[model samples]
Target: MSRRLEFSPTVRQKIIERDQGCFFCRRLYHMEHALPGDLAPKDIMHVVARSHLGLGVEQNGVLGCRYHHSLLDNGNKGLHREMDSMLQDYMRELYPGWTPDSVTYHKWL
Candidate 1:
């Protein structure tokens, strides 16, 4: 069985700082499409699920608001591609030797 990782406070803080806010779902609502604001707390989500052997390291983590977290956990149809792209960019920026193929973001999806 695959194991899940618990983030240390330092790691969690780093992720929060890096992501700033939800990796997905940030947008301007037009006058005709205004919706209630959400302060949904961010969650560190696994790019490749633990069940599928994804690690619990920062490289595999994506910051997601609660709603998006559940969507990913439950395999609900959602905006995962955006999240994957963001994470890919982040990892590449922070870890110079890291390659896109080094992580498994698309296979699980």
Candidate 2:
């Protein structure tokens, strides 16, 4: 079967500019493949996650490496929840009233 693929050049450029290129490792101008795999070059994970209310927008997303992406996906929820709590600590510091449950995503986004 044949499959069609789509990617947003505008979003890619924006992410490249915003992250100075690499997302997870924070490198610059890294090359990326269309999908994730060992053959895929080091690049950002521009997720359109169903759990994050993400609309493929640059702002409503995250940057991660392939390894980290896999870890985040298959890692234990307790660890993930801990990490989320730590992240929320920073978010609450900025927003003041942000709660842990407010931005928590059951799935990676």
Candidate 3:
């Protein structure tokens, strides 16, 4: 049996803070171009889907605007690569190389 995977609210907030804009198009609030005065909800997307055993943690999250989020969910190959590359870059920048496991998500869990 597969366990339900979930990210804590703190992790979701961290993802929003880290990925200030959409990973795909850099839109802060909406799609590539949001209408003036419009406010669209942002989505915390998984760089690797949960079905693929992706961890429900900050390292695996990216903030995406609604349109891009759907595009990712619907299997846009190009966007997948783009998001993966971005996540890898972020991981390197944030962690450099493997540190003690305790320094990673150990404390969070």
| Predicted structure with the largest TM-score when compared to the true one | 3
- Candidate 3 positional error at 74, Å: 1.1
lDDT of 1 by residue, 1-109 (tens): 2333445567778878887877665632111322334336778877666655655667767677666665556544554565556656767788787654454434454
Per-candidate clashes, comma-separated: 0, 0, 0
Model 2 C-alpha lDDT per residue in residues 1-109, reported as the tens digit of each score? 0111122577656655655523433432222422445324444442433344334444433455565555445544334544344434544555577553343343443
Better of 1 and 3 by lDDT: 3
- Give lDDT tens digits, candidate 3, residues 1-109: 1222467798889988887866765634225544433335788876666666566677677777677767667644456566556656666677677222312233236
CA lDDT of each prediction against the hidden true structure: 0.60, 0.43, 0.61
- My TM-score estimates for the predictions, one after another, are 0.60, 0.45, 0.63
**Regions of model 3 farther than 4 Å from truth:** 1-4, 27-39, 76-78, 98-109
How much is the lDDT of residue 39 in candidate 1? 34
Q: Rate residue 47 of model 3 by lDDT.
A: 64
Residue 43 displacement in candidate 1 (angstroms): 0.6
Ranking by TM-score: 3, 1, 2
